[model samples]
Target: MTTTPRFKSDAFEAIHSAASGLHRSGVVGKQTMREFDALCLAEAPHFDAKSIAAIRKAAKVSQPVFAKYLNTSTSTVQKWESGAKQPSGIAARLLQVVKKHGLDVLV
Candidate 1:
């Protein structure tokens, strides 16, 4: 899964390029690259009920299973899908990851 953020500025772009080179040269470790990638992440998008349900469908998993991957409860997934609640913080970011990379990334 790609954790790289879209380059919005030349500075960040250059930084990422340099870091990537370092990683490729073994000056940076996999764990460090992952940490850098996390720091490069953009703000998570807000998912409406329909969008949340669509993502869940795309993953081809039941609500309970999706919740398990997301480290949330089935009831929370239901609430999000039903528009009774919204996922914020890490939860929202995780949904974005699953939406972009697929459910297997979490596994």
Candidate 2:
């Protein structure tokens, strides 16, 4: 019989404990866990076109301003926000970063 060794048992336990703390504190819940799983498994944001447009609208910025902040073109922003086109590659990455960090890079 052959035995295989698993790695970093202590580190895994520590991470699990931290996640449990987050769950206990209500910082993480079933919905959050599901979303996290989707993000990890699908490698994409959960937002759809309408949701992206709504987020842009809620940000209260014009397409040009939003595009500038995203380091993309105004036309591309219009396409994305209007659901005519989807952001991809670096554009998608920039959008994700901006969603998390706001327009801090613009300043």
Candidate 3:
């Protein structure tokens, strides 16, 4: 993330910061902090097979290596690239991060 995340507004950032402080001070529980974290996170955008392949290529990694970073199987990556299936949930979100911040961030 940057100084201010693109996903959240200034108000959300302020609230999140306060929630983070509360979390650190043990004033807020992990569950509440997790809710705050979810509010701050952007929903993963849908990517077509071409876009998925391009992102992988741009990272300069093979399917197996990319799969390793994403904690998924190489065949899953292949399925995504071939339009046989699509990435969802965590994998999709990780792809968004890789697309925006580069694959190095995940490492």
Index of the highest-lDDT prediction: 3
Name model 1 segments beyond 4 Å from true. 1-42
Two-way lDDT contest, 1 vs 3, winner: 3
TM-score of each: 0.62, 0.50, 0.61
Kindly give the stretch of ten consecutive residues in candidate 1 with the minimal lDDT sum: 1-10
lDDT of 1 by residue, 1-39 (tens): 655456546776777778889999999999988876666
Clashing pairs in 1: none
Task: State each model's CA lDDT, in order.
Answer: 0.88, 0.65, 0.89
List the pairs of residues colliding in candidate 2.
none
TM-score of 2: 0.50
Candidate 2 C-alpha lDDT tens digits along 40-104? 33243444577667667766888787777777788877777667888775577566766776667
Please estimate how well model 2 matches the true structure, expressed as its whole-model Cα lDDT: 0.65
lDDT of 3 by residue, 53-77 (tens): 9999999999999999999999999
Clashes of each: 0, 0, 0
Order the candidate numbers by TM-score, best to worst: 1, 3, 2
